[model samples]
Target: MATEHGVHAAHGSAAIANHAHPLDPLSAPEVERAAALCRQRHPSEQLRFVTIALEEPAKAAVAAFRAGGPIERRAAVVAIDRADGRVFEGRVDLAAGAVEAWTHRPGVQPYPILEEFADADRVIRADARWQAALRRRGVTDLDRVQIDPWPAGNFGDPAEEGRRILRGIAYARDADDANGYARPIEGVVAVVDLNAREVIRVVDEGAAPVPAADARYDAAAQPRLRDDLRPLEIAQPEGPSFVIEGHRVRWQRWRMRVSLHPREGLVLHEVAYEDRGRVRPIAHRMGLSEMVVPYGDPSPGQYFKNAFDSGELGLGRSTNALTRGCDCLGEIAYLDGVVAGGDGAARVLPNAICIHEEDFNILWKHTRAAGQTEVRRSRRLVVSSWATVGNYDYGFYWYFYEDASIECEVRLTGIIQPMAVGDGPIPPTAHRVARNVAGPIHQHFFCMRVDADVDGGGNTVYEVDTHPLPPGPDNPHHNAFAPALTPIRSEAESARTVNAATGRHWRIVNPSRLNAVGEPVAYALLPGETVAMMAGEEAAVARRATFARRQLWVTQHAPDELYPAGTYPSMSKGGDGLPAFTAANRPLEDRDIVLWYVIGVNHIVRPEDFPITSVHRAGFALKPWGFFDANPALDVAPPAAACDCPPGECVHGHDGHEGHAHGAAR
Candidate 1:
């Protein structure tokens, strides 16, 4: 890379050296003397130097001189040198003069002026012999005669070429920054004729000006370029399942079904049993003891016997449940095109089911319809026996058990999107904090609150607070475990305490608090319910229940039509039709949902979580399920077919040569 200054140096040195003669091998005095003499003799000329080899040294030299003003006469001569260093100088002989004279001819002149020709007649006459010579050699254009002249042996061309050369020189000179002119000289000349709407041509005298019509020419304008600007179109699948109606569903202990309607929309329906029922179904009669179990001691199959014969269990409402027990079984049968089949037959399978039990508190209530008590009780006991059947295979399982819920006893379990380590924490200094966290974080003197809604609709709610504890390994099951757990505090005590981690004092406040670790908790309150149980190791406690709820919904109620075949991995098949693999059933819409989540920086850092730190939250919304009819690209109509004739051929006829000749002339 040459620097700007380096370029300037190279150009300047070359130009000077090309115009000057070297004085001495190495002598200041000799160099100065030669420079002085050259300048004195040709004050307006810049001298250049070049070395030439000689056959022998000679004492003969010639001195050339011109007598004219600055605008016209210029001449040159050479002096010969001898081995003795003696110089012989005189007027150049005839041979030299002939060479010089030839160099001075019209075409050979270094600076020929076309306007100086008295008329075009003089030019035509002077070039007549040359033109004839060219014609004899089969050359036709009189404007293209070539000639060479002088010791320089430079070539010259006809008058038109000379004019074009001069025009190019003028353009270059005008464009040169050193000259500092505003626009090309030729362009300025054209501007003078702008009002006349005609092109101005420079011509020698005695030549008639070419008519504008004769000189007119046309140029094809390039086609206007266009950009393909279009919004991206997302293809949606067709079918009832692809619509919003496909997303609603219902669930029960061992069966799940969609509430279908002719037009209104789909609804959820589920069934469960209580211990007070009078009649029960035999496990063997229902064929409930054949299912496999995946894990856990005592096995779900062992409990099926007890649950089938004894009316000791109760049924409760659960937000999360799978419909595999009924819907899945139906779907398999439908695929096989069977209405019903014998027991143990491949087509006769139970609905896909996932079951789990939680302790209930005395505050809970259980009620059942009574008219057909025998049938209902029989169905419950019979189905309960199948809780362990097919349990080990991992499709779906049912549970029949009993227990009591303790106050503040929060059972955290639900369907949650798969997560990985080092994936959840919000980085500090994010531009937008509130929109990212699952919910807002609330800060106070001694505690921080985390609040997140299940979805934008607030159907489910999650909230938790920070407590102080010794730093240790985090619990793997629930993401709640942080190295340090902040100690829990009463509202009054929290207001008075200063956060040790952040070295900030806290003050009592209602909903809003300063130095809060997480955003203030907020969730949709179910109708008639005031508060939900909150418990877990700090972080785990807040998200576990919500995750569990989401799981239940996905397993039991998600619409089959919306998530038809090929949409997700299969979970079961062989004996009964069902996909064998379960997928993370999370749905995000056209735009991802944002969650604002915050947790304590450390167990002791209360004020640090203040102002709420944010982490991004995203979920997918259900979309239509199907394939596009055709490839989006290349489906466009082909451009109108083009004619085969060459451009201008049709309009100009077979003598298309005429159009080309005219175009070339321009």
Candidate 2:
């Protein structure tokens, strides 16, 4: 980021385009060309570009594409005219250098541009009322204060209606690199109009003094360091066991194509696995559609803290530049992502995605009484990326295992959003972390969209749960339990929650494909740590992000229905995405379907989570259920010997007649 007007601006560089794959991201030249084309048609200096990225072709076109075939390249663009607050959408044909379509969107607000954040900071700091409020808290130095502009959520205030607004949160900093979050200036909120670039109101409710103590965790600020740790290293002598061509990856029996979306970040397409000599498709596309972080506090300074990270602030644009040994280990492959800044100039972020393989201890091991032992190692392919949105950091990891299972994990870590506390008893909704500093309770809910094609396209979803039978004719001993499978026949019955007491799971099966025992080939979704939305049903947070209210939702596959939250969630009223799509009550049995699974983490702030938080993980898994005849890893070879022991001694366990007893060490 570059410093401009005492605020950081987004980074980018101009370049040319020479794309090879049709699904590849839009190049720098394409972004510049698209913006220029829009500017020509609009002919206004007030137009600011919001989003500029590659417009993906239809699924049929991508499926029929060959290596050097005819391609029709296009770009999707969104811009807003700052003068009248009118939003525009356009499409550009790169090859012909022509505008394909241009339309105006009424009564909608797109995501905020990166420059507006800086502009908001500049405007708030210059306001006399904001300065007076700061002086009332005994803070006079303006340069040392940090002002963060947050999306001002709609609350039905007539004064703030039909206007773009941002709330300002301020903190006192000791130095340039010091932790500003350690000292929050609470009870002062600045409401600023983005288009007008002026402070609308400054509310000062309390006079809590800022904490003077500094909480710096850098090595230079520490007095001593640990000296008893040893370095551990991992190496792959023969290199990795996977092959990559462009965006396509092949490892072991798994195959898929990876792409970077401007909002969704990492997206997987055509995920399939090979059994024997046949390739079977599992999913057509999978990615994180939307995620929300809603705070529990309802004070004047904290009520409007619910933010749609992926929709309001683009996760793909917030990616971090990962380092080699620090972020990943062993033999690793990196992929760069191209994204545009506020100026619609594309730039390549180096090492935005990391790919590697990890040894997962053991796949399976057994020892027989006949003095024979066998063990095989387990390995998984990992594709991961990280994004830092304001005061929090997030990691998205996709793991593919040898036994034909897929796991998607979300790791959360970073500085917690802090609040200033007085010398009274602490509030129940927060925990005191440092001197006069409190950490607020919050929840992070993530929605994953899986376009499943269980053997082919047509599939059905069933809710499977275990029910114990009564001790009548069914169970004489009163210990008989069996699974009860119920088909979800319509969208009306698709929204459901997890019943962990019954070991419940949802399965997607192809009714046309039968397994060896006449069962449908299927994959089951195993829910991990999850919770329902804590907000009330009528609350604005719950209404805007309705996907989080339920753990599982099955809907008919539609290309335009991508985001779990609607296309524009910033300051949205409510009742958009999931609720609107499921209103049709379409048939879901034996039809092309999509699964929307929500993972929730209820974060109760701890004292140890103050200065910086350790990684906290939450996600779900998909396991093959009746899709395979037997164990898929049965053909995996045994691991090589770790020591120079004789071959027979390593595997042969001693029986009653001990002959060369095997040592405890492998």
Candidate 3:
């Protein structure tokens, strides 16, 4: 991030068509040049590719004084030598226009995890082995069948042996609803080793048959509408409330740069909100670090289905090109993302990033003792991206508010994963999402990495709790309460939980930088849509993602400790990421720190989830505490009342906050 006007600007090199800043992605030409180098190295031997992404360069100290470390130009390319199945990592310098460094990641297949899904899907369509399993069910119209390969993760299995494998299921689809898995052709499973490019195991119970898709319970189809029930269109002039300048977006006083990452979906960096005439730093960088979706029911077919969404498979790599009016509204700006294809070529996911402003209904309001009123309608700058992982679709959105707070949210929608529970009552372990389609109960865990450079990098964790004061001489009534603010002095003490009952919250404060009242400039961790991972430490699912164990883990800053769940968790055994990082119990107080905040959903499927379900959001906000002198947005006056009601009449009503406990972690 380049510093201008005492504010750190959003980082990005604007080399593409309509991009604003350089969240630092490799240009198509740069990636192509790197791929040519890999091909030149492989020459005659067949090579399988993994990832070719921007290897961030180290930043200089003067500019990166707050967020410290590398922010230079470099690219990383990973590929597998198929002749011996060896994976190689290549680093290229954009300035030199050539490969500057190379290394071999021994025993690990570069593109083993995700590419297998596509390979498995292709084999089922082209090969005869999976075709035979389909023939047994009397389905000859193979064109109508959709073979979707799911991530069959290795659960400490010794048999994996560094090979790319995928488990596939077939679904009968007549049209593309983005919910192809809704119409499940049950009682069939295909185990494919992508390295071998063959279906190794075919599970056909024969007891259960493929459910009929007679269009009666089509999940994607909308109900027939007559010449009635037409709604009025809502429009806002002034084009949009936000403006995109390079990779950066400026909405009111909130300014943040958006990055298109290969692993992390939508990364927001150089985040700072303007308060009055001065600018203050909120978060230097933030995004989803790692995620795990662990299924509850563990049978022969379901046990191996836990997905390390970010680690095993790349979320940004699978991002879908968003529709204009459907995905975003008003005047919009789109940023295309480039990812390494299966052949190590730079593939474009068009309209991969969407930047726009959303009307959140209200910002803030107040009433006077006299017949007077004041209110402000809220609008937010939204940076979003969508990714489809097998049966589920996740839309990652980062909302920047005028109040100087940033909300990181994940919207979960898409077809539910249908099971072979033919014509029976809803199973105890699962809930029926569609007709005869039992969607297994599961949990989606997401850890957001927030680098809060409150005033600078020297930050401390402060836990504030409301405690009942002892009924002594001072407290005549037993109802007296005292709020205690405890600054966590160690890393081990920072592994805390979100206590919903009490007014419990955590704050990342730069103790050295104090506000006018002599308090540290800080941002409060206001809990958002919340759910903890249910899998215990003993479970294989826990072994896959140790970060999901706690809701919050604060670790002293180390450049190498980037991922919470270790990198290469596809066929990994265990003990690499968060648990291993925290085991040393490193010093944490008043140091540069990274806060891993976990938020999720215990997705107990309901019938409403069918037919391309509604968005289930889980997130939290980094609210300004003493970072602002007052309500930073207070200076900006609200828009005039547009309704017919009298001023201060209906205005007394809440600004849409009823049961919404702004402080509740739940």
**Largest lDDT belongs to which candidate?**
2
> lDDT (0-100) at residue 439 of candidate 1?
12
Best by TM-score: 2
Q: Comparing candidate 2 with candidate 3, which one achieves the higher lDDT?
A: 2
- The lDDT for every candidate, in the order shown, is 0.18, 0.83, 0.72
Report the C-alpha lDDT of model 1 over 44-85, residue by residue, as the tens digit.
Answer: 321221111111111011011112211111122212111111
- lDDT per residue for candidate 2 within 171-250, as digits (tens), equals 98879888878888988889988888788988788657688887987888889988998998887766778765556678
**Candidate 3: segments with Cα more than 4 A from true spot:** 1-23, 41-45, 59-71, 109-118, 125-132, 137-140, 173-179, 205-207, 214-223, 226-236, 424-426, 640-666
Per-residue lDDT of model 3, residues 438-512, tens digit only: 777888998889876776668998888888989989898888998788887777786778887777889898888
Error of 1 at 57 (Å): 99
Instruction: State, as a TM-score between 0 and 1, how close model 3 is to the true structure.
Output: 0.88
lDDT of 3: 0.72
What is candidate 2's TM-score against the reference?
0.93
Which portions of model 1 show Cα errors greater than 4 Å?
1-666
What overall lDDT, based on C-alpha atoms, would model 1 receive against the true structure? 0.18
